[model samples]
Target: MKLRDELNNREGYQEIIEFYTSSINEYEQEIELLLEYEKKGIQKYSNPNLEIIKSTKEELRNAYYKILKSMYSKGDTIEGILAIYLKLISYFTETWKKSNGYVQMLEMLSIGIMLKIGDKDFKLLIEAVKKDDPQDLLIDTLISYRDENWKQLSGKLMWNKPYKALQEVIFLAKEDKNLSLERLHKYLKKEWFRGAVEIQTHKSKFNIHSGYWSFESGALVKILELDDATLKDQQYYPYDMVHYKE
Candidate 1:
């Protein structure tokens, strides 16, 4: 495993991992406290306070996802990365059930699919994604992998962004595998990092600069079963994750 050169500060990355770990623990403890209060029939921490509990759990899962990305940036083993990913999924599923198909981030849906989660979990992801109404063809195409009858979603994405590259790659995948690979290579080189300036520049306390990964690209590769020989070295392609095996 090699550390992403973009994340040059190994010490800073470790610090981020530690910070999120601590934040996750705090959020967990806060949830436990909230539950205890609810169980005791406290007026303020009544059923209505479930929203607070839900929010805390959301924060906890966000921290877990951050750790997963940071650990990958730190060059952790695939097994280790998968372990944290599974934990995050478990948390996500619990919250989704409670919130009636809530999805915290659209990107997470693609990541979960590419990770090769079980069919039942994938179904939950599909439902949550549909509920979120992503309105993007790329996400709809992704869902079409599981539900072949899934209709094409309607909307236009801002063409100037990096996602346009991904959208082109997805369209090309249906026509020419070679062309798709070429487009994906171009995406990794030019468009990927340019789209995420905040993380690249480390502008905020919340941004905990993790490794840059194009999970959508990884998902498309897995779905299309494309030869990623040319993409293995691409900066944001997440090649190992696309090829990860249990």
Candidate 2:
């Protein structure tokens, strides 16, 4: 594995890695403490605050996701990245009961497909998503992966710019490979990072920066078997994961 040029030799890479590592450890310890409180039937004032446990788990998974990205930026092996991803998926499966948000669900499913996770893990991903409304085109697209059916629902997309742009890529993927590739290219170049506050500025105040990647774009390429020859070098497109075998 090679370090992503964007992150290679960049200042604060080690600090970012250390920050994520420490955050992951802190979240783990917090989960343990919460579990102990639950076991002992402790309460904060009158409320048991069990919801905090679930929220803490969400934070833990997020930390894992960041570490996975940091590992990639730091030139970690594929196996190492996959290991962290598996932990993320497992934790998500165990804790996540409903759709966190549209973007979050999309990113999770996309990364799962891009990684070519095992059938069991993939099914868990599907099950987690089954909690969302069936009318959602994103949910429909995600379910299509398991059913091996592609649904054309471009007419049903909402007017939200970023969401619509991403949904277009997935829908076009099944109809026209070339157009899908073009839309993906356009999304990566313009729409993808429109509201991404995390990486908007060149420098980070807390060393939380990690490589930017469009796992969903890679997932579309993997699911539809679209040739990404032209997209391989596009900024934010995770080309290596798209072509990763075994």
Candidate 3:
């Protein structure tokens, strides 16, 4: 659909615009407050116990989560919520550059996790990450351990795994100019992937290896110019370290 047609066809279009406008304004205002706090020498992790920092982070998190949940509960379509998510990501990217890299890394990863519950969300995130932190390299290197094996996250590739996988791909790309999807998957198998399956029942519909995982894995494949067949094949293994030979 044309942009105008999409806007015109969406129900409560004006309301959606108003919500985004208001939310953006509020988010900007909050960022300003955080900046002012920083100016006052209020470091996010100044305290020995980091109580103040933790509290502030929790508050920031709850507020964002509340808004996201509220939007989802109101039957806002994925596109609508995605609009807000991108805006938030934009703001967070700026905030990330200003704050300590590690703190913002964790924050962005958490937000990424929440937003990556669906295929659309994960797809959106890949675009945003490229724009905000190209190649997912910044956060990846900052939080990722270079020597860690992929199998460590075999069955538990949660919040940071996708980025880690992408980072691994970067290394793989350099090491093997002839890198292929099968080769990449072989590399992945050597590290952290234990595999399992979850039926798409309503209660477990959003579990890992669901739509988002496949979408994310696909994104990584595309970014790395690798085939996606191996990733698709790995989704069904109910055991760890599949076809291993030691």
Q: Which ten residues in a row have the lowest lDDT in candidate 3?
A: 237-246
**Highest TM-score among the candidates is held by which one?**
1
The C-alpha stretches of model 3 lying farther than 4 A from their native spots are: 1-58, 61-81, 94-168, 174-180, 183-219, 233-246
**Better by lDDT, candidate 2 or 1:** 1
Model 1 Cα lDDT, one tens digit per residue, 1-246: 567535446776788789998998888888788788788876464456578888888787778887887887777777787778777876775565423332234456667766777777667767765555646666676777877767776545523376777777777878998999888888878877777443444655454677677777778888787899888778777777777782
lDDT for each residue of candidate 3 in 124-193, tens digit (9 for 90 to 100): 4344444544233433432232213211223222345434554555567656635645454654455334
Q: Looking at candidate 1, what is the lDDT of residue 44? A: 60
Candidate 1 runs further than 4 Å off: 43-48, 93-106, 149-160, 202-207
- Which candidate model has the greater TM-score, 1 or 3? 1
Candidate 2's C-alpha runs over 4 A off are 5-11, 44-49, 94-100, 148-159, 170-175, 195-201
Give the best candidate by lDDT: 1
Q: How close is candidate 2 to the true structure, as a TM-score?
A: 0.81
Decreasing lDDT order of the candidates? 1, 2, 3
